[model samples]
Target: MKLPETAKNRLEDALKQLNLRPTQQREHVFAVLLSERDHPTADEVYVRAKKSMPSISLATVYNCLEILVSCKLVKQVNFDREPTRYCPNLAEHAHFHCNDSHRVYDVDLPQDLLNSLKSVLPKGYEASKVELSFHGTRVDTTPSK
Candidate 1:
């Protein structure tokens, strides 16, 4: 998938600021992630990216993902006993895990909810950012195991 001009600019800026060398593999990997809302796993990304980079190894995919995460370009989500999922959205938002489908979806938190949590917290417990993930069985009769 082609990245938007603004998004591509932001990524290039990030790479330059971090003094990290950019490559075709890295650009394709990041673009594949940023173009989707589904929080894909490393293997999932590898499968998709392999179409373009036929020789790309799983290790290479993993290493590229780590680099992206370390640079704060991707956010990692750890769900119930599962491999880590990667998301490209950097904004402050919560996640909802659908137990039935084992899928993760973005959830918007209310301002009052955030304020209430902040107010009730003890002093010196500063909140710079918030990440809330709820894990539970969906309303479906037969939940996924």
Candidate 2:
């Protein structure tokens, strides 16, 4: 994947601030996430990143993602899944996952829903951030074989 000059510069700056050497494998993995819109798991990013960095290990990919997350270049998502996914968009937004395909999508819910959720909060409960996800499949779409 071709990473934009802005993304590369951002990555370079991040590595410098973190006092970490920039590597081809780490750059390739970071490029995959920055170049694509879909939030991807470590394995998914690894498959794409491996094209440019054949020697990159799965464990290495996970470690790189963790580093990126710590540097605020990437965000990790935990939504009742074994393998957490990472999002390149650091902006506050929600996601929806198609349970059938396991495809993730950004979501924009109604204001009423967000307001209603806050209204129902129990005592001593504070909503840090809203993360709403709707998991379902289209009625007419056939499931993967």
Candidate 3:
């Protein structure tokens, strides 16, 4: 998949800021994540990336993901030991996992609200990150069209 010039520049700038060189494989993988906002597992990412780069190996995808995570360009999400998923969103937010549909949705909260969670932490203990998730079945509340 060809990334737009601005997207490419963003990726390049992020990598360069991290002292890492941007490569084709990394760009492609990142593009896949960008194309789909849903949190997808590595295998899912490999399948999507293969559509454009058939030669992309699963191992390579894993490596690229690792680098991206290390560079803080992407985030790795884990749901109770389930396959690790990749999330491109960098903002402070939570993930809601639908129990019935098995879909993960990004839920955003005000910065103040998220910061309030840190108050629960024990004194002298600083939280590096705050992770919140909700798991429930979605009910059909709307009339059928």
Candidate 4:
């Protein structure tokens, strides 16, 4: 999948700023992530990237992901007993994990609510970041016969 020109340019600039050399593998991985907004694991990324880069290896995909994360171009989401998922959304948001589908969705929190949540911290305590996730099954609306 081709990346939007703006996103490609931005990513290129970011790599230059970080003193990292830009490569096709990195571009392909980033494109895959952007194309599929759904959070994907390293393996999933590797599979998708292989379609464009037939010789791409799993290790290379992992390396590309690590570089993207280090460059602040992507965020890694973690859940208990589950493989780490990669997200390109850099905004401050939470995640909701569906119990049945095991799918994750981004949840937007009000700015005031985010601030209020930080207000509960003890004195002299500071949080560099917050990761809040909700886990529940989606309500089924199908009629039962």
Q: Which candidate has the top score in lDDT?
A: 4
Query: In model 1, which regions exceed 4 Å deviation?
Result: 137-145
User: What TM-scores do the predictions have?
Assistant: 0.84, 0.79, 0.93, 0.94
What C-alpha lDDT does candidate 1 achieve relative to the native structure?
0.84
* lDDT (10s digit) by residue, model 1, range 1-145: 7767786677777788889887777778898898778999999999988887899888988988998888789999887669999999877678889878888998877888888877877888988866679987667588679
**Which parts of model 2 are misplaced by more than 4 Å?**
109-119, 139-145
lDDT of candidates 1 onward, in order: 0.84, 0.84, 0.90, 0.93
Winner by TM-score = 4
lDDT of 2 by residue, 13-92 (tens): 99899998777767788889987799889899999888877888999999899989888999887778557999988766
> Per lDDT, what order, best first?
4, 3, 1, 2
Model 3 lDDT on a 0 to 1 scale: 0.90
lDDT, model 3, position 58: 100
Winner on lDDT between 1 and 3 is 3
Comparison by lDDT, 1 against 4, better one: 4
Query: Alpha-carbon error at 133 in model 2, in Å?
Result: 1.4
lDDT of 1 at 58: 89
Candidate 1: 10-residue stretch with minimal lDDT: 1-10
Clashing residue pairs in candidate 4 are none
